[model samples]
Target: MKQFQNNSLYYDVDVKIIKQSEHCIFYEMRNDEGKGSIKSYQVFPGIKLTYNDFHMGQCPYHNPLHKDILEINHCREGRFECNFINGMYTYLGEGDLAVNTMVNNRIIDSTFPLEHYHGVSILIDLEDAAKMISPILKDISIDLYILRDKLCAGDRCFIIRAKNSIQHIFSELYTIPDEVKYGYFKLKVLELLLFLSIIDTSEQFEKRTYFQKNQVNKIKQIKQFLTQHIEYHFTLKELSKRFDISLNSMNSCFKAVYGIPIYAYIRTYRMQVAASMLLQSQYSITVIAGNVGYENSSKFASAFKAVMHISPSTYRKSH
Candidate 1:
């Protein structure tokens, strides 16, 4: 039932809180521009949430309020920093989570240029929460109690996974009918709470495994960086420098994670962009080539043929 006032100068904002439960609710908000803007809402209380995916070089800031909300951030892509109270700072990369509690908090900063960050947040409304938990049975109370403790403990990974799952659930709410969406949203919220609850009881989820998780995180960051700056010609060396990894490391990571090298990935991404432009826009082949980071038309043609198995002109003709 809380109203959000639009403070963003970039666009008009509208937010809708769809469903509310003892723990969380569903919500949606949309920005009018639809460019670098998102509108979403959820009924999960106790968190004032802000989810943003921005271009490189932009630093987004949220000034601390007198009454602090429990803040959890997961960097799905790119890199950034969280500046806390008393000048404490933490750098977060993909798969990394950061937590700031009301007790000790400050501002957040993004360190990389042309970076993107996507994550979710859950703010606990303590006063309302007490009333909600009063009616639950002792067994159920165990989990809720544990979750509450961890949030107070400022468990970073726990918060990240919980918020990430809730955000995914919120995204799915948009497609379903109101009744079904509400039912599903509540289920997801419960799942998130239970996940947090288990985290409180067990220490297994806190340990980072070297399996695909770390590589997956790096891949997400690289892919997102590529998607946002598709027009720029990205060399392996440049990408390595941008991500603070070596060329061999970058290539191995991409190949192991994506089943392709960085160049092949970029080429495919470029060709896909070119195909969309060819079909959606009236830009000529030369312009499209330039737009996709190709300088020579013939070179672009060969690369396009290698990927699509057809020349750019032929592909255009077919489409």
Candidate 2:
């Protein structure tokens, strides 16, 4: 475990080493919230690719800023939340790519707004990675230092929302044959860096949504209220007045934080609860629909089918 701490990938976080082989290391962290595991592979010297699968709400990471390290993250599922030193909150939804170096932007901690996140992080020690640039490709050149400067110029952290180029690069990584995993990862990492190197920073960046601390807090309160009282429906105006936030701000901030609008989130949430009731409890479809805020069984059946893709009776019977 102590030896693994020296790895730039886990240097700042306190992770227990579960096991390690010649080229890969497995680490796990568990607390009251939940458990998570990180499987890291040494793709290249001073360059490592880590697969992060977390089932907890938050993971505490010490702010051990390393200027030589450049971090690239891709959110494959769920939502990633982090507050920067500037007191602003940023999020990464599915298919989003975030590039930042600790020197320019410091990540205070790792948080999953949805309580579970699956993603990938590529950690590059600029100095070390530069020294090990493979000579296998004669026509292509990769300079880690130059890449960092280009992407994280000044205090900027380059972010790209879901795009076809990003999708093309990372989608295959999630599903690779084990026999070719190591070799496949090297190819993908090189492809990603190459893509970043040539990308036009001015036109390719996404307009990232940054929320104020107060707004985030209030929206969280709104979310808690809505989830707790799923039996009732609230309009955007009603929630705005109840939470004392502007209408536009409420809609955008809620979408930014939770990756969905308030109504969509609550609708999915209600169906989820109703789903559990259908399976766990001996409740009638009408009773279950009423519990989730539907007065008319026909209307509830329509909404449930729209969300779950099956009628309530059929869903219950299928299981």
Candidate 3:
């Protein structure tokens, strides 16, 4: 086990390497709050699989450590955000699957909601992956290397629709017993590769979208602005004028980065703040809702129920 300071959130992270072999390396990660336990398996020269069952409050920003690594992520239980080197962010909600990479050691930021997040990740090294699949390259036009380079050529990402095949592969991983996990693990990786190899046409690989670093940063600034002024409401036109961007561009960019419209992000943040107040303060429900930017209790309750699935009083009492 070893310890390191995560620069992004200024928190300590602990890692325990359970095994390190030429074919596979197994490890686990936890944060100081005991809210996280992420198990990882690095398979040989090219592939890695991770199962995340943790609640690391707000994980700090960090770059991918591998060279030429490409990631496929599926969120099984909770949602989070993935920030790329180019400043863009993607949301990984339950059942959402995505592939992303920026080639090398460039930084990628991550944010987790304030609860347990369970997910699975599969990473592939382009060069090594290409070599492993060389035997099949002679017949197919889409080499994994070519697929990565041409498809992701730049700081790129794709939110793939979760098909039954991908879902089945991960569902098995979640349920496989310890006795045969290793063999099943290898089989699943092969199955995943096979699925990727045949699922898309050459052009379909290029269909995904990405955002710019400056644009992403702009949205981040807007998020900070909203956080600081939670009681105040801003409209799309107001935000666009404030940021000196077009309305359509702002909407698209904001959705691309944060995975929701601007107002949805605001409401989510407001409810989260309301939740904290409910637990930590003696404020009345109406007062708490007002403090979090709601003018009417009924409206607040409806909105809260939409995101939290419970009434404020119930949530407060339960906690």
Candidate 4:
């Protein structure tokens, strides 16, 4: 086991890598009060784990770590407020799991000590995770669309149970003989994966309106292709030809799953990309528009305004 420790609110934290393999790493950490802790993992490239702790009587401040992190917080104990970029605040109780997609802006507030309020977090590399779940990615995407913006408490319970099971396995590692620990740890990890798979399935069944696994998978592939080539103008006919589906069928699939047409999704994706560039880069309006596949700056501005209700220039200025 490798151990790392520090002692500063801005940087103080300790991590112990209990076990590691080619595909996954098992680690634990204690974060500093009023500070955020972030660590990247080689086990799953492109994935990182971050932990933040807030002392009682102090409110957690917003600390921006510029990366697309999928935060999974399993609140071991205590109450906290999750403040999102959209100005929505969620109250998280003990045994709750908070999934935050690091898209725009977000923060967490806790009125408890670092040790008192603890949680386990797992960050799966987006591309790697996509490949690992490729067989079911489309179904998951469709389920996400149907479940949009609602998290059931039962889902949280399932996640908590899985987390605890993993923790329990870790806790026994030292007590048990080293030879037994290896075998038991492997078993526990397999069990955890199976539990996660079951949770994913349950969430899908509970949330999705239509659950055609095969069709959903195809839609996922299309979405992935579009995301990869967002700069290129893609027509329904072109996409249909490439995916071997009729134009009508392609459009219907997208609409049924995402509640939007393919063109609308592309336009929205372009605007979102442009918005990010405007906030994070020094690129000019015309350059940003063209970078996101908009040939005409005026056309891009018009489409952005239609969805956002604000001009691109104004939006950039405000953010």
Best by TM-score: 2
Give lDDT per model, in order: 0.54, 0.85, 0.69, 0.51
The per-candidate count of clashes, in order, stands at 24, 0, 1, 0
Per-residue lDDT over 62-114 for candidate 3, one digit per residue giving the tens place of the 0 to 100 score: 34445577778888876666666656555666776777674654446666643
Off by over 4 Å in 1: 1-68, 71-107, 110-121, 142-174, 180-184, 200-265, 272-319
TM-score for each model: 0.50, 0.92, 0.72, 0.36
Residue-level lDDT tens digits of model 4 in 244-306: 877766776566544467888777877888889989999999999889888899998998899
Model 3 root-mean-square deviation: 5.7
Q: Predictions ranked by lDDT, top down?
A: 2, 3, 1, 4
Q: What pairs collide in candidate 2?
A: none
Q: Candidate 3, overall lDDT?
A: 0.69
Looking at model 3, report the run of 10 residues with the lowest lDDT sum. 1-10
Off by over 4 Å in 3: 1-37, 42-46, 53-71, 77-118, 124-159, 206-208
| Regions more than 4 Å wrong, model 2 | 1-5, 8-14, 60-65, 134-138
